[model samples]
Target: MLSGIRIVEICGIGPGPFCAMHLADLGADVIAVEREAAAGAPSSLLNRGKRSIVADLKTPEGRELVLKLIEDADALIEGMRPGVMERLGLGPAECAARNPRLVYGRMTGWGQTGPLAQAAGHDNNYIATSGALYYNGTPAEPPQSAITLIGDIGGGALYLAVGLLAGILKARETGQGTVVDASIVDGSAHMMQLILASRQKGLVTGPRGENMHERSHFFATYRCADGHFITLGSLEPQFYALLLEKLGLRDDPRFAGKQWDRARWGEMQAHFTELFASRTRDEWSALLEGTDVCFGPVLSPPEAAAHPHMAARDIYFERDGLLQTRPAPRFDGQAVTPRPLPQRGEHTGAILAALDAQAASVWG
Candidate 1:
């Protein structure tokens, strides 16, 4: 869908590379810029489909080269703190001045103008400020440090990509560009939109794990006899009834007429704990494979790859003896093929040649 779009990715860690990867996957012509020494290593799975070039932005000549590339680019993406780009003489103002149609995207943990914009932080710090950390983990324990997936990839990369695409489209129409300030903390807070609405309407409780979805026996994870876990998400009454029937607890008087009654929640949870522990996870999975009971066995990464449904969907693929996930949402009746990731600066000469060709034509 992004066939003719051109993206210049300033190499950094985490979310910036991920956002560029998504653009490349969607058929964008993405060129990644890395420091010279950072090249020559094996490419990472996330760097697939991108051509790489080495440019030391600290040097006047290298910074000038980057400016030249930006002049012809549809979009430029960077993951750096607020003033870092300005200090390096490659901030949005400089880039946008050279190319009025450039969509300049900045990705950071805090927003560009916030008090904490210049502070050092990571995914955990960002999610903590957004209230996302508060709802994580068990009811009795402190909020657990979550996997970086939510804050870094979900809130940071995905939102930055969306913002960049939107800005590019607008620039195409208006003949002017805009800057996208995509902050992980802001994005994480935005992700809690639905939960905030629920809280405002008095439907959600003040404390963690006291809410219906968080605390209810019908919508949580339970341990099985083998210490493996299963998750149940029977949110509706019909689904809840199906889960009870599948677990052979339909006729149990302790669970009768008190499904959502908060007063009886403790008793109901205890009953569910004991009942779920009676069977192994595999045994439970076999019994509830295709039912509307809304049941699934908790699977680790390797186990998820071998799952029958995942295999059928071709969710994971192996490339050059490396195991990696395929790009999401098949398109145009064509399965997205996995391209081998590129080593840093592998395409530097080719990219420079193309740029020189364009410059010669313009000069002529």
Candidate 2:
């Protein structure tokens, strides 16, 4: 869908590269500018489908080379500390000067302006500060989040991608540029709006696991006989009824008609815990895998890849001995086939040749 768009990504770790990879998957011509020293480093899945060029940004000529590239690019993205891009002379203002229609995207854990803006932090630190981590884990334990998934990928990269696309749209119509400051803290906090909105219904009250989502027996994870886990999300009335029927508890006084009796939830959950442990995960799956029970066994990445539905859809595949998932949000009922990962600086010669520029002119 982004066939004609061009994105210039200043090479950085984590969400910045992920965003560029996503755009490239959507048919954008993405050029990743790598530091000269990183020419022969280990391969990164984040570099998939992107062309690579190496340069030393510290030199005036190197910065000028990128600025010239930006002059013809639709968007430029960089993940650096608050003032690093400005110091390197590749900040939004400079890029916009060269191309007034550019969308300059900045990604960070904290924002470009904040108390901890210049401090070193990562995914966990950002989400923890955003209050999105408050309800995670049990009430008895400190919050623990999935590494990098919530903050970096969900909050940072996804938001940056949306912001860049939106800015590009506006720039094309208005003949003006935009600077998108996509901070993980801000995006993660914003992502909590759904749970926060539950507060209006008195569902998100109390502390931690005391809330509706974490406290209910029907909406939690259970460990089975084989030490594997399964999840249940029988939230609606009909689904809860079907779950009780499948477990042969439909006529039991404790659960027959008391799905919302908060007073009995602890007792119900304890009973469920002991009952689910009597069978292996697959055994339980056999009894209730596809119905209104809203059930699923917990699966690792490889197991998920081999699952019937996922395999039927061809969602995951192996490449270079590494597990990888296909590009998401398919268009016109088709999944995007990912291109091969480019070797570091593999396109340097051709890219420079296209510009009619020499390496020494930029490297010096």
Candidate 3:
């Protein structure tokens, strides 16, 4: 979908490369600039589908090469501290001077103008401040954090990708560029809108794991006879009825009609825990996997890759001795075949030659 769009990515860790990977998956021509010393280093899966070039941005000549690429590119993505890019002479103003239509995507943990913008932080710190990590787990447990999912991937990478694309669209229409401040703190807070609304409506109450969906028996994971886990999400009335019937508890007074009764949740959870443990996960899956009871067996990564449903969709595959994910949000049933990850600075000579030719055409 982005076949002809050219992007210059100033390589960094985590969210920056992930954003560039998304653009590249959508068919953008992305050139990743790497440090000369690490030019031949092994790249990660996030750098797949990008062409690499070696350059020391600390040097004038190397910085000039990147500036020249920006002059002819539609966008640039960089993840750096607030003033880091400016110090390197590749900040928004400098790049915009060369290409007014370029979208400058700035990815950072705290955003460009906040009080914490200059402070160093990681995914956990960002999500904590944004309220994304304050309400998980049980009330007794400290709010747990996943491995960079909420703040880094969901907040930082995904938002940066959207900002870059939206900026690109506006630039194309008006011939004017935009500086996208795609920050983890900002994005994470924005994603909490639904939860905040729920709180205001009194749909959820208190701190930590007080919400019905988090603690209730009908909406949580349960252990089985084999020690494996399964999940249930029978929140609606009809689904709740199905769940009771499937578990042979339709006639039991405790579970027959009290799904929304908050006071009886502990009792309900105990009942579910005991009942679900009567059978193995596989046995429960056989009885309720595809029904309106909203049940599913919890599978690990390798097991999930081999599940019939995931296999049918070809969601995971083995390539180049690595288990890789297919490009997401397929275009009309067509997914981008993920290319092999490029070695750092693999295309330096070829890219420089192309740049030379373009320069000659303009000034010769």
Candidate 4:
């Protein structure tokens, strides 16, 4: 969908390349600038669908090469610490001077102007500081998050991609460029608004485990006979009723009370734990998988990739001796075929020659 849009990505780690990859998957022409020393380095899955060039940003000539690319580009993405790009003479102001309508996207953990902006940090630190991590795990344990998903991919990369696109839209309309400060801290906090709204409604009151989402047996994970896990989200009254009916517990006095009865949750949970353990995950799936029980088996990566629904949708595939996912938010009711991973600096000479040719034509 972004077929003609050109983006210049200053290669960094994590979210920056990920955002560029999403754009590339949508058909953007993304040129990833790498360090000269990184030439022929092992390619990353994130480098898929992107062309690569190597230059030393510390040198004047190297910085100029990137600037030249920016001259006709729609956006520039950088994930450096605040002021690092400025020091390299390739910051927003310089790039905007070359292409007035460029969208400058800055991805970082702490954002551009906060006290912690210049401080070094990572995915976990950003979400922790944002208060989004407070309610992740069980109350008995320290809050644990899935690695890099919440803060890095969801908050950091996804937010930056949206910001860059929005900025590109605005620039196209007004012919004026803007800088997008896409910070994981800010984005993760913003993502907490749903839970915060529930809190305001008193549905999420009390201590961590005592909250409605946590305190109920109807909204938790249970272990089966085979030691595999399954989840239940029978939050609504009818769904809870269906779950009890499926388990042959509809008439049992222990589970017959209000679904949110905090006083009975411990006893109810104990009963459920014993009951679910009577059957293996597959057995339970046979009984309740498609009803109003709001049930799902907790699957590992490979298990999920091979599941019936996932395989039917072709969501995951093996490519280049690695597992890869198709581009998301699919268009035209079709999955976007992932492009090949580019070898590091594979297009450096060809890209430079194109630049030289463009300059020659302009001068002629």
Local accuracy by lDDT, each model: 0.86, 0.91, 0.89, 0.91
lDDT (C-alpha) at residue 209 in model 1 = 76
Query: TM-scores of all models?
Result: 0.96, 0.96, 0.96, 0.97
Which residue ranges in model 4 land beyond 4 Å of their true spot? none
Residues 1-54 of candidate 3 have per-residue lDDT tens digits of 898999999999999999999889888999999877643567878889999888
Candidate 1 off by > 4 Å: 200-203, 332-334
Residue 302 accuracy (lDDT) in model 1: 73
Cα displacement (angstroms), candidate 4, residue 227, comes to 2.2
Which candidate, 1 or 4, has the higher TM-score? Answer: 4
**Which tens-of-lDDT digit does each residue in 240-302 have in candidate 2?**
999999999999999988988988888999999999999999999999998879999999999
Candidate 2 lDDT score at position 66: 98
Ranking by lDDT: 2, 4, 3, 1
Looking at model 4, which ten-residue stretch has the lowest summed lDDT?
34-43
